[model samples]
Target: MDDVYVELAQMYDKFGISDFSVSFGDSMLKYFDCMYPNETFKKNLDICCGTGTLCGFFKDDGIQTKGVDLSAEMLDVARSKYCDVEFIKCNASEFNDGEVYDFITCTDDALNHITDIEDVKRIVKNANVLLRDGGLFIFDINNFDILTPGEYNKDSFNGYSKLSLVQSRDSDLIKTDVKYYEHDKLIWQKSLFERDYSISKLTQIFNREGFVLDSCSQHFLDEKRSEKWKLIFKKVE
Candidate 1:
């Protein structure tokens, strides 16, 4: 499949998706802190970490940070934005660094983009291998339970860009259409397709990969949007 983020990277930062990532990550990390009281997160790895915004936020908080993504174009943007972050280009399911981290995050429903169940399982296993004992891992997903054919979602980023999505009524696929504008002049347009993963199946994979579900929330920045979910897991084995 073609790399969607790479095509969007040129105009991605203008959309302020980075800000949403940090804000969402703050909520998720706070939940992690509450779940694992007294746990100090010293190192973090953001998987499928686009634009490295969350990693940048982590760096600002004095945490050692690294971000991994498959798209080199996206990494170029991330590196330019946050030079301090150890941005690596590799498939999330196949990423491995010699060092283990105390905290790991995969945000923005990135997991759902993997259409293969085996690859998703590999990503979960990699998380277990990447985290230290009792480390916390947080990730978000677009809920599969309530997903229906023809479901549509859209969001605008302060007049810089607009993203529109529509789900196929015949399959678990989603078609994303994004338009970027510079001073009201259309600059770029792109379309991409993604598949949504079943939440129950993902939980089962997490169990087999040595992770225990620690928390779950449907809130996106205080909005109770049941169609979205963020789950926190702990490495227990």
Candidate 2:
């Protein structure tokens, strides 16, 4: 596993991550509304918050939002975007803290980075500890069925393109090769990895870790299962 994000941190917003975050954040707000109805969240924690994108959304909604990420470089970008918000540098497995939150989110396939199942279990335990009773944990992951492995694809934006290849290894992990181009010249390249876990397995783990699986949607509440699964977990005593 390489810290490809260290190099991509500055260009992440240009790489389409920010827009995707905004769109995904909208769906999360909708899901929260569906679950809580008239309730208001007092605090929110964005686990593995890359550029503080989702945190921005929560802040805009009047929720006190704080973010944690493993990359200081990524947090630099996030701080630049929202100087008022707090962005802490820390790994998911080491996120033990005294503060409790009403809402927690790990979006954009952040959990998949923990290839080890035990590490993932640790994160679940930490989530249970950090969340107040009835708090919600929302996250999304790459669904192998939709993001079928293969090839160098192109994602174009603002007259630039990111050429990338996604390969699914036999070990149940997915590897991504990303290259950014400017005017047809290579600017940057990165390698990223994601672990694949079946929805059933994740649900079982959540149950074991003291979370109740509230619901799951592909992308949005109304959307069908597609390239990813947006899962909702509620912490209960």
Candidate 3:
């Protein structure tokens, strides 16, 4: 495991905001329904499924779901809360099993954490190998256009909860600093770094991995430029 991922996994719960999952899950389900209205899938894989939020949602909707993440700590929390679902600790960039999945998802900018474009391409290729024919690949990424110009840096207050976020971008790295406050007291702070890749680059990589682009939608909840754009790809040919 990468040192950064290992460290972040330990503080995953403290820095992670659960509220975001509610809206994210709804959007994901909407896309899933649109793509496969009549199909009934027996097995689903949520790759890089931090805290297994999507897996929990799928289980609640009566689907058999399994989650994979790089962090054992996060998987522990996911397993403890969602006992019905299986959570495996594994790196998304290089994961393989003998079985194929009906659907595979890597959501919430999970792919951005992978530093190398070649690695991203490898992961997509592996995902293609792991999916049954016509299986859907749905994921999202924080738009570089939004983050490069440092538009995500700002302070917002909500009653007793206050949030401050800052972003720094250079040639090879993009770093985000976040601080959470409650009752006017500092609660926690986290620094997250992601490797940057343009949308065009990602699209090309997906194409090379045998995925046909389907749809791309701007993130519905947030209006900020740093918001995510949801993308759906179909395994074809």
Deviating ranges (above 4 Å) for candidate 2:
152-161
How far out, in Å, is residue 1 in model 3?
A: 6.4
List per-prediction Cα lDDT, in the order shown.
0.76, 0.81, 0.72
Q: RMSD to native for every prediction?
A: 3.0, 2.0, 4.0
Order of candidates by TM-score, top first? 2, 1, 3
Error of 3 at 63 (Å): 1.5
Each candidate: how many clashes? Answer: 0, 0, 0
Per-residue lDDT of candidate 1, residues 44-131 (tens digit): 8999888888988888878889999888998999999987678999998888878989988888778777767788888889988899
Error of 3 at 106 (Å): 1.4
Candidate 3 lDDT over 1-237, as tens digits, reads 344444344445454553355466676666667666886565778998877778888788776788888787778778887998888877776777677887787777878877777778878988898888888777778777754554342233334655566778888577777666677687777777787777778889888888888777785434333377777788885
lDDT of 2 at 217: 77
lDDT (Cα, 0-100) at 186 in candidate 3: 75
Superior by TM-score: candidate 2 or candidate 3: 2
Which model is ahead, 1 or 2, in terms of TM-score?
Answer: 2
